[model samples]
Target chain A: MNIKKNFRVILPVGVLALAAVAWAGSPQILQPAGPGPSTASFTAINKVFTGDWQQYGQLFTSWQGGLFNRIFLLILTIVPVVFLLHYIIIGAKSFSHAGTPIKFFGILTRFLHWLAALSFSLLVITGLMVVFGKFIGGGPLVMSGRSVHLIAAIVFCLSAAGLFLIWLKDMLPMPHDILWLLIMGGYLSKKKKPVPAGKFNAGQKVWFWLATVGGGIMAWSGYTLYSFAAPVDQIRQMAILHNLLAAGLVAFFIIHLYMSLFAVKGAISSMLTGYKSREEVAIMHSRYKI
Target chain B: MARMKFLCDVERCIDCNGCVVACKEGNQVPVGINRRRVITIGEGKPGEKSISVACMHCSDAPCIAVCPVDAIYQREDGIVLVNKKTCIGCGYCFMACPFGAPQFPSGKVFGARGAMDKCTFCAGGPEKTFSDEEKQLYGQNRIAEGKVPLCAAMCATKALMAGDANVIADAYRKRVFARGSGANAWGWDRAYGKK
Candidate 1:
């Protein structure tokens, strides 16, 4: 590589690394307020509770306990109605099932996808139930809902990892993905237009990355909450991260659900049958050599 | 009219961990979980100070706010208590409490969390007062018995004060006045402002 090109990448990375080291090593920053007696707990509870982040921790707690439930409620109730209005206005892109079908996915791919989807739905439902547990007058039901949420998280992890490996190539950002995004993936209209997309469109790619990579982060943050022995501030940070990312996931999940189930007639059958009709492939996957 | 509260005087606290043991002896909390802990800052160094902290049984307790199962509740007297049977041990309350008052028996990564336990402010839980179920699940219902919590009562130096909020504040104010240093004795200027 040219020296100029190498320096551009290396300089920024070096600066960031040095800054991190400086921040961590500074006696004033994230360092204990002063040298204390050696009598410290393994969890560093002292340093944790008395940090600048405590203020932000309060903000996060409010968002998680108070705001996130309303956010989810709005997503669950309002988002679908919006999609329904879209469906009513633009109508489903119907394709004849009698047409010659092309192999869009194999059985293995279908299994991985369904596993992730179903478990992700379970996670969403159980997590929301837990968030609304107080309003639900929580007892044994909400308690078990937490259990279901954990189990669903584990299952989602396995499927997400598989999907990450299987779909990484197709999900990579292509230059024309910009064009697909600009035209809204040829969605939002009743016109049958050829979209610049390969096996997966830009919207699908965004969801794929979110479901795979974002799901990984969700699992990590969720695990930290589950088995938390971290410094107290870390818990707040992780909770905020987990819940904030969850908000995005929830919105996209709704979009994906409606698109597959109703927005495009016969779209749901493709994953189940591992095939798409010739018309759908032509319109949706215009760049694919069908 | 009596709003229960906890006040630990940093001036008198000696880091003896007596409150910790007293709580364990009285509450019989789950092993490996200390509902009350002494956090010593500047240990072994000059100006080293130890503070005994637990659930202050806050008027608007963060733990109660964040509990997903509504297992944590606050009585009218402001003594926050937890219903152990319903606690899913999701640990959100544990995360929310800056004091580290919430305790979990086992925090292993692969295993499910056991129910959280915390200082019940000696008022016990939702179970009937002094009922066998209350004693079994929550270890004691001292408030109904008209006694101070075991930790504060057994404190040798009287650093840990437990009682109504007004009473504790009055007692602390008298202590500060008796010392004749005004607000400086209590670090009021640093924490709040000069009088």
Candidate 2:
């Protein structure tokens, strides 16, 4: 064998000889004995209620109280600022010519929309007060906030149900919606290029779906949390889901507010007066059969 | 200043529930609520253990952190207490507590959850110490009187020890030394240490 190969073979034998000598002094490793009752035994016995699993509830609390609240506060602060900047830059879309106004939203549709809008606004306000009212007021504020929130939640759920039932068909995705989404719904384009859309654009459909689905989740989770009948783990899970969905819905609410008030010229009028100018509709929603 | 704590010797606890009864009697905790409970693990088994659990009054209490209305608070002496007047009965603290310490008086659905109740460590609440209202709403204020909690004082086997952390810890160390083993303070690592 070469010197390098001979050294490698000798090295393994030398190490093994040293290991055997070392192991001779201490033949076996034993677990240490400690004072008092072993927590391991207790934990193994009560594994379900008191173990590493309970820490998950603590983790959820940390996330909800620390990170989730901060995210909500950030959204509440930044969203308005962002929307205001966009409004300043773009302003509200306006038409130079006033075309014949066409009836778009019927009485029942507008009624349902406003009902949902009003109840949702109340829920948001009361919910915020409950979460953040300590900074502004005291115990009474929180108590009142919670009381009002309960009532508002009921109204919001009912109105959401009505809105979902009435507008489900119109809000479904169509083939042309893909093209509308591709061009950013013609909102960002400097050129007057109206994307083909029905009465509801792809963006509006997204808002509708989010509101309906997210609202459903909020209602169910809110009821579960409010009931206090579920097991502690399930209650905790529901609370986490409720906080997350509420935060997401708040974000969508801001976007919907911006789109209605500023992004589309006659969107608010269609909801309020049940009418949209024919020219405005033709430019904004080119595929609508007015 | 003393940082008060509770150390339960699981080896000595026999699950007699004397601590639970003593706590209930001392605090006059309402009919539907329990401030403390004794949980027996692996009953009739060889390594069976019993632990008397209440609020650990944790160093960083999740209850205080999660209370939306700022109802839950920790005293300078490290006992966690709740203001029943401020608690809204929203049950946020109930879900947040890792030990499931918080209890609501009513199980009625939709808005009838009374104020949240939990172990006060016999320290009472924001109400005047030893006041009738405090006694009614929050049980006893034995800590204010410089006495051990009713539950600890009433423990049959002396399993539940309560007082200043150093003093109780030293006593526990002595017991463990005398016995030469079985010194595990269950939940101590979780309540006070990262481990």
Scored by DockQ, the top model is 1
**What is the CA-based DockQ of model 2?**
0.35
Which pairs clash in model 1? A36-B42, A36-B43, A37-B42, A37-B43, A37-B44
Give me the overall lDDT of model 2: 0.78
Report the lDDT tens digits of candidate 1 across residue range B50-146. 6777777765666777787778888878778888777877778877775667887653334667778888887778888888888877888888889
Once model 2 is optimally superposed onto the true structure by TM-score, how far is the C-alpha of residue A231 displaced, in angstroms? 3.5
The C-alpha TM-scores of every prediction are 0.86, 0.85
Candidate 2, residues A211-256, lDDT tens digits: the string is 8867876877788787765656667777888888888888889889
Off by over 4 Å in 2: A1-40, A52-55, A96-99, A189-192, B44-47, B107-109
Model 1: runs farther than 4 Å from truth?
Answer: A1-55, B107-110, B181-195
Per-residue lDDT, model 1, residue B20, is 91
**Residue-level lDDT for B107 in candidate 1:** 31
- Model 2 residue B88 lDDT score: 71
